[model samples]
Structures are given as structure tokens and as C-alpha cells.
Target: MQPYAQNWTHVTEFVMVGFAGVHEARLLFFTVFLTMYLFTLVENLAIILVVALNHRLHRPMYFFLTHLSCLEIWYTSVTVPKMLAGFIGVDGGKNISYTGCLSQLFIFTFLGATECFLLAAMAYDRYVAICMPLRYGALVSWGTCIRLAAACWLVGLLTPVLPIYLMSQLTFCGPNVIDHFFCDVSPLLALSCSDVTLKETTDFLVSLMVLLVSSTVISVSYGNIVWTLLHIRSAAERRKAFSTCAAHLTVVSLFYGTLFFMYVRTKVASSINFNKVVSVFYSIVTPMLNPLIYSLRNKEVKGALGRAFSLRSWKGQ
Candidate 1:
């Protein structure tokens, strides 16, 4: 099977069937989705601001936390605005030029990869702090964090570039109507009229890479965390350690839980919608939840918030 062989040529534009499935519900969907985006933006930005301005919060972990917020802002931008527009009849279906489609694919994959790796990094941070109290500082130093961050961003950007490029080169001469809301990889691949052997192979390999790399990192980090937790002599210390790890664990579970479901069960067609919900979980819901979980559940984040509010109250009074 030829990878780039164009079968049904002349398909240039794609009809994206976002939330317009029910015409009556379109307005409601738009309102709610728009609100979600607004809140996600505000929530994520607040996290960045709170972490940045709070001198007490100026630590390696919080530094990464801010970056994750920034990441969510960009990640959502890749899909939501256009989706909302389609709901309001401003743009029924975007005639995404070939270049635009690939660019979308690249950014989507890049952000997805970055988040996966960042979650792993956070997990490792928790692991080191819990499992190796004495050596945590040395192992996950500020310098090391920066390097890991750079590596994650670089991998996030570069790893998907080739595949997206490869996928774009393949001809899409058939039905261009994408069933899903966004211009994702799998759904896009289904639209291609060309034989997708190479593309599927590449996708499978990439899926394996995403799963193996991120999961392995989290597993190793948590393994160390567990081993260290087992050595705790007092119940209070154990609780303290558990609390510190809880937020990160929640994020890891949320991310990996959805991720594994999507990629792991790629064989079934019904799994696609399931994957969409999972993607929604990570893309839409997780950003809001991250700040809530980290701040509301975390002592340090709560303390930071308290200090922030106190300062504001004093200024107003």
C-alpha cells in the first residue's frame, strides 16, 4: 500500500461537526463552552500570577506549575475558539488549508506531549520529595528542573513535527468531513484517501512512545515514592508525605487514566468518542481542576492564597 497515493482528489475543505448536532442546543452549547473557556483562562492565569508574585511560593515546583498553566492556555486555544464560532454560525466549517491542518496537528501533539511529560516531571518531583528526603534537593535541583523542562518542551515540539509533516504529505482526496470537533490525528487520518499503512505504523509507534515514555517515568517516580512512604515510622509523617503527593497523584491519574484509555484501546471505533471525552477531561476540565486541586488541597498553595487575599484586603481597607 502506497502511503501518499491520492485516491479521491479535490477535497480541500472539511466540515467540522462541533456542537451543532442539535440546532436548538447550539446556543446553549456555545454559552456554556464559551464560559468554560473564560473560566479556564482566568483560573490558569490566576495560578500563574499567584505563583509568580508570591515570594514564598518561589520554588522549583511552583515554577513548573506556572509553566503548566501557560501550557493549558495555549492547548485550549488550539481548538475551542474555532469550535465556539462554528456554534454561532460565524464559521460553519473552516476550510483549513493544507498548511493550517498540519500546523494544527503539530501544535495539538506538541502541547499534548508537553503536558504528558510535565505530569511525569511533577510526579518525579513528588517521588523524590517523599522517597528521598535527604537527596531530593540534589537530584531534582533547580538546574536539573530547568533542563528537564527544556527537554520536555523540545521533545514536545520536535517529536510531532515529523509525523504531522508526514501525515500532511499524504493526499486527502476523499470525504473531508471530520466527525470530531478538532482536527486531531486519528480522525484526520481516517479522512485520507491514500493507503495509511505508513501513517498507521508511524501513529502506532508514536502512541507507543507517548505511552511508554510518560508512563515509565511516572511509574519509576511513584515506585520510589511508594518505597519511601513504606519506611515512614509515624502515622503523622506518613500523612504529611501522602498529602504532599496527593495533588500530583491526582493529576497523574487523571492524565494517564484518560491517555491510556484513548491510545490503549485504539482498535475499537466506539473508543473514539470515549477518547474524545477523555481528551475533554484533560483539555477542558483538567486546567480548572489543577489549580483547585493544587491550591485548595495543598497547604502551601492555600497559605499563598491567604497571604494574597490578606494583602488585597489591607490595601482596600
Candidate 2:
């Protein structure tokens, strides 16, 4: 072993310092997160089921919505259960093996990247629908939608491989304490004893590319959508057109807002506590809110949900 390597022992595991010094409210925190997790699962599953069973929703828009719901389910799952374990003090709720940490980081990064691209695709779908109604059917046909969705997944799957492999190769010698709830990229990067300039630069460049491209698409799509909506002569027709895009806009704002603050910033490790708070919004809160945002704002989704449950109710009776 090298002299520096010999000086310090390799870290086998890491302790996640999640909400440390909060022993007094562990139960309360556990209850809140548990409820949110379960609710997120139920809501996203309902969306998938409602969209699948209802033939009326067999369109490109609903197809993308179902993909989003499924992504949210897996996205939230990658981090929240481990967080809940910390709150409940399971094995002190903080210890994770090195392999486990990297696995979490890889999965989380992949899903997040996927959501960014998927949201952009959804925005483009809306733009085509509102801005070019005449050609929307041909432009966003099922084949096109399938291809777009597959590309999003493929890019997401590939984006994290380099960053995560770099992270796994990093030397975590002693002080294996992660200051965040889960093994996120920043926190893990902060804990590494190895020189992480290359890793940080690689991660930053990858993130910037994903965020810039995705956000640009979303912005341009919405810009045209807004322009088209403004040109409609009737106020009612304008409102109707705008409503279709509202839920998606809300979700995109919530998701991308936190992401921009967290990743595309000058100082990632400046404030650990604040980072945790912001992370909560995107990783935990946004998934829970997606179902509510879409279902509440969307008449079609609401109607489908009602019909789904009511049909079951009638069958039971």
C-alpha cells in the first residue's frame, strides 16, 4: 500500500447523520415521512391504474402522464425508505455499507435525470398539442411517444454511469459520516478523502448538460404554448387551453426549481442543512404533490378516477 493509503484505514461503511440531534421528535418525523411515502405510492399507483383502465385516456398526453407517475414512484422510493429508517432508529437508521451508498446514489441520479428529460418531452407534447393542433396527432403519435419515452429512459440510464463509477472509486478513509439523510452525490463527494476535482467537474458538466437542455426545451415549449393561448379570441377558449398546461407547469417548476438550486449552483457543500431542506422538496415533497397537482387540476384525470372507484363500488354492491 502507498504511504498515504497506509496512514488511514479504508472506510467500509458510512453513517448518515440524518436530522441529528432530533431525538425528541423522532416519532413525529417518522410518522410524517411514513405517511408521505405511503400517500405518494397510493396516489401514483391510482394514476397508473386510472390511466390504464380508462380507454378514454388512451392518448399521447395520458401516456406521458402514466410514465411520469411511474417514474415518481421509483424516484421517491430510491431515497425515502432509508430516510424513514433513520427516523425510526432502525440500526440507528443511519448506517449504510459503502456498496449500498453508491447503489443509492446511482439509482437516485438515474431517476432524477430521467424525470428531467421526461418532463421536457411532456412539455413538447403540450406545445405540439396547443401550438400546432392541426399536426399534433401526426407529430405526437403513439410511435413517436414511445420513442421519446424510451430515449428519455435510455439517456437517464447512461448519464449516471460515469459519475457514479468515479464516486465508487473514491477513497473514503476514516470519518465515514455522511451529513445528509441519504447517500446523495454532494454529501458523498464531501466525505471523500481522495482528490475529487475530476469527479466534481465530471458530475457538474453532466448535470449542467442535462439541466440546460431539459430546461431549454421546457421553456421554449411553454413559450409557444403561452403565445398560442394568448391568440385565442374567446376568453373561455383561452382559459381552457391554458388549463391543460397548468398542472405540468406547476410540477416542472417545483421539480426544476429545487434541482437548479441544489445542483446548478456555485457552492454545493456550503450549507448542509439547507441542502437537506431543499432536497426534501424535490425528492420527497414533489412526488407526493405530483398526483395531487395533476389529478386536482385535470378534469379528465378526476373524471377517470371517479369512474374507476365508482365502478368498483358498484361492483362491490
Candidate 3:
């Protein structure tokens, strides 16, 4: 072991000091997070439900969206409930077992990575639909969609394997407090007694590969989309095409904006408080807004939702 690794206490537990200096407003924080969590759950669930039950929504775009909704639910669930606990001082809100911490890290990282690929795939789907309107159906068949979705999940599941292994091998010393709400990579790494230079580099490379590649693909797709839109002579056609992609673009911006701020830049360059705030946006706020963004911007989703509710009402009657 290195000199730094030798100093570790081999601590088996950690205290998550989430939202420090906010004890006075813990109740308010708890109430707010609780409400958001519920809304996120209901909204995401409704998306999945509407997509699954409606035959009209069985196309490639909605198929990916149904899976994306599933990912969002689990992705946000991995952190918010525990953060809520911290707010209300339940289950020793500050304390977390070592195993629990690792589990949280793995799940959060896995789902997050998966969402990156899924988002890129979604952008590609839109690209096909808008740019190659005639070939969209044959190009984005059910088999192809399933394969892409599986690849996203597979790659996401595999990408974190090394990172998680690196995290597990690290030694934790005297200070076991994770300065964030969740067991995120940086906060947990900050507690390690091991020399994390290699670990940090590995994480950066992994994040860059996943995020940069996906961002590039989405950007290119949208770039082409913009170029294609310009050539359309009809004002109504251009508006419809742009509107179709606006919701996805909004989602991509929100996800990547906070993500790049946290990871793409120098690690630990920002204050822990700033990182936490950004984390809340990407991890909590973004997931909640995805369903709303898609539903509000999408005519098909709205129509499906309307039909679903109408059918439910008729059944109840």
C-alpha cells in the first residue's frame, strides 16, 4: 500500500452531510423534495403507462421513450429518497453503510450512463424521421430499436464496472463524511485514503467517452436537422419539424448543461455546494421534467394521454 493508503481508518460506514447549513429549513426542503419525488414518479409512470397501453404510440420514438421513462424513474429514485430522508432526519439521515454507498454509486452511475446513450439514440431516431422521412419506418424498425436500446443498457452496465471496482478498492480514513446528498463519484472519492489520481483519471476518461460521444452524435443529428429544415419551403412544415425536436433539444440541454459543469470541467474546480445544486438539477429536476417536456411538446403523446384518460373514464362509468 502507498503512504496515503496506509493512513486510512478502513472505515466501514459514511455520513452523508447533505445540504449542510440548511438545518433551519430542513422541513421545507423535505416537503419540497417529497412533492417533487411524488410528481416525478407519477409523471414518469404515466408516460410509461400511456406508451405501453396505446397502440398508436408503438412507433420507434415512443418505444425508446417508454424505456427512457423507466430509466428516469430508477435513475432519480437512486438518490432522491435518501436525500429526502436526510432532510427529515430519518434513519440517521447523515449515516450510510459502506455497502449501501457503493450500491447507490453503481446504480446511479449505471442508469445515468444508460440515459446518455438512450438520449443519443433518441436524437438519431428524430433525425431519421425528419431528415429521411420516407425511410424512417424501414430504417428504425422494431428490431433495430430493440438492438439499440439493448446496446445502450449493455454499454452503460459495462462502462461502470471498472470505476466501481476502483472505488471499492479504495481505503476510507478518519473522515467518512460524503459532502453530497448522494454517493456520487467525486464526493465519495474525496473521502478515500488511497491516492485517487489514477481513479480520477479513469473516471474522467469514462465520463468523457460516454458523454462526449453522445453529445457529438446528438449535436450532429440536430445540426443536420437544422440544415434540412432550412431547405423546406413551406412555413408550416418547417414549424412542425422544429417543434418535433424542440422538446428533445430542451431535454438534452438540461441534462448535458449540468453534467458538463460537473464532470467535463476540472473535477473539484467548483464548490461542493455548487456541485450539489447542479446535481439536483440533472438528477432530480431533469427527470421530472422529461415526461412533461415530451408530453407538452408532443401532439402524439397528448393525444394518447387524452385517449387513455377518456377510456379510463368510460370504464369507470
Candidate 4:
């Protein structure tokens, strides 16, 4: 192993060259990102607020969704604000300190992994509701849901610690400029001058463990759901059951699909400009859409929204 310069000699700050070649459209970029950021915050907050205030939505599905909304709030925040700042005066986001960068990376990874686990838990809840309606009440009691949610958060918080610690011990004697919107693991790894093989391998194993396990749970749950749906004599009941899982399935595909491409792939071209866009998609777009996808299509959420608004109007009168 080559000796790196001492801490004082290492670069303390990194330049984030976000959305390169868009200098002329800075305002456009800022406005768009700011709008999306506000939307994500508002929509997710509304979900959390609605689920909290409305007794009608206090069931297991919405319980998980409330937590998901809470997670989305932080997940999108970890990256969008910095990305928005990058669009400021020329070379704006070029000053993130090493500590700040790692903090962002850790929080981002934690929330993302938590969402993966939470989604799978929700899938299991759906499977129990559909495939074993007779046992639904006992199978997914409120206490069980709470424990599952707790596990998701606790496990997620632990997932990135080892990898981040390993990465932190590495020397960053190379260029301090990151070519992406945020301090993602891949871009950060690319900037390190030290041997990153161990860190990379650890990251891969951890990612595989999280994604593969969650995906397998979801797949098995859904497979059972399909089998049960087929056995049902009524087509309407089948459709209703399937509809309930549709939004979550869409969210899972959007999230896991992009995640697999970003982290699981064997080789990510160093010069590829598409990575930032993909990062934006998950870190920003997905959070903004989760509420819309889940709430708009969900009849109970819509009913609750209607009631919440009606009550507000009546009080104003």
C-alpha cells in the first residue's frame, strides 16, 4: 500500500460538479429542483400528518406508509438541497467539507436501506391480508407492525456504518472534485487514492444483503398473493386485492430497479454522465412520487383527505 499524505495534506473539501454543462440554465435548474424539493416535503409531510391525525388510516398499511413518508422526507432532503445549491453562482457546491460529505452519504444510505426493508415489510402485510384473510388480524397485529418498523429503521442505521468507516480510513490524495450531484459511494470511492478493494467489496456485500433479502421477501409474498388471488372465485375481489399492492409494487420497481443499476452492476463507466441523472431520479423524483402514487390511488387515503378538508372548511365557517 502506498503511503498517503498526512491529514493536513489531504483535501478537506470536495467540488461537486453537479449537472455539468448546465451553467446557462442555472435559474431553470434551481427553480425546477426547488419546486420538486418543496413538493416532496409538502406531500410527504401531508402523508405523515394525515396518517397521524386520521383514525380512519390507522391500520397496518397506512402505519407503514406513515413511516415511509417520514423516511422520504429525510431521504430526498439529503441530496436535493445540496444539488439545488450547486446551481447557484458559478462553482457553488464546490465547498462541501469532507465531514459534511460523509455525513450526507451515511444519512442517505441509511434512509435508503430503511425504505427497502420497510417496503418488504409492507409487502408481507399485504400478503397476509390477501392470502390469509382469516388470519390477518393475528398475523399482523399492531404490535408486530411496530416491531417490524422499528427493525427496519434500526437495521438501516447500522447498514452503512461499517462501509463508511472503512471508506473514511482511506486516503483521498486524488482529485477532490466529484462529478455527481451528491457524495454517492461510487463517486467518492473513485476519488480515493487508497486501495478501495475492501471497501468496494464490503459495500457490494452489504448492498446485496439488503436488496436481495428484501426483494426475496417481497417476491415470495407477492407470489403467494397471486396464487391466492387465482383461487378466489370472485374477479372483483381479486382486482381489489391486486390494486392494493399495485402502488407499492410500482414504487419497489422504481426504487430497486434504479438501485440495482447504480450499485449492483459489475462496472459503472467512470466517464458516464448518466449517473447523476439516475441519482436525481431516486433521491428526488421517487420521494416526490411515492406519496402521489400511494395516496391518489388509495381510496382510503382519498376518503381521509376529503374528510380532513371538510372538517377544516366547516370549522372556518
Instruction: Give me the candidate number with maximum lDDT.
Output: 2
Candidate that beats the other on lDDT, 1 or 2, i.e. the better one: 2
lDDT string, candidate 1, 24-106, tens digits: 98888788878888888987887888898888888778878888889989998888887788878885544566667677778
Ranking by lDDT: 2, 3, 4, 1
| TM-scores of the candidates in the order shown | 0.91, 0.96, 0.95, 0.95
lDDT of 1 at 251: 78
Model 4 lDDT tens row, 98-198: 99999999999999999999999999999999988899999999999999999999999999999899988988875999888888888888888888888
lDDT of each: 0.78, 0.91, 0.89, 0.88
Better of 2 and 4 by lDDT: 2
lDDT of model 1 at residue 215?
Answer: 85
lDDT of 1 at 104: 79
Question: Which regions in candidate 1 have their CA more than 4 angstroms from the true location?
Answer: 1-8, 92-94, 265-268, 271-275, 310-317
Question: What is the TM-score (0 to 1) of candidate 3?
Answer: 0.95
Count clashes in each candidate, considering only residues at least 3 apart in sequence or on different chains: 1, 0, 1, 0
TM-score of 1: 0.91
TM-score of 2: 0.96
lDDT of 3 at 240: 96
For candidate 3, what is the total of clashing residue pairs?
1
lDDT agreement of model 1 with the native: 0.78
Candidate order by TM-score, highest to lowest? 2, 3, 4, 1
* Candidate closer to the true structure by TM-score (higher is better), 1 or 2: 2
Worst 10 residues of 1 by lDDT: 263-272
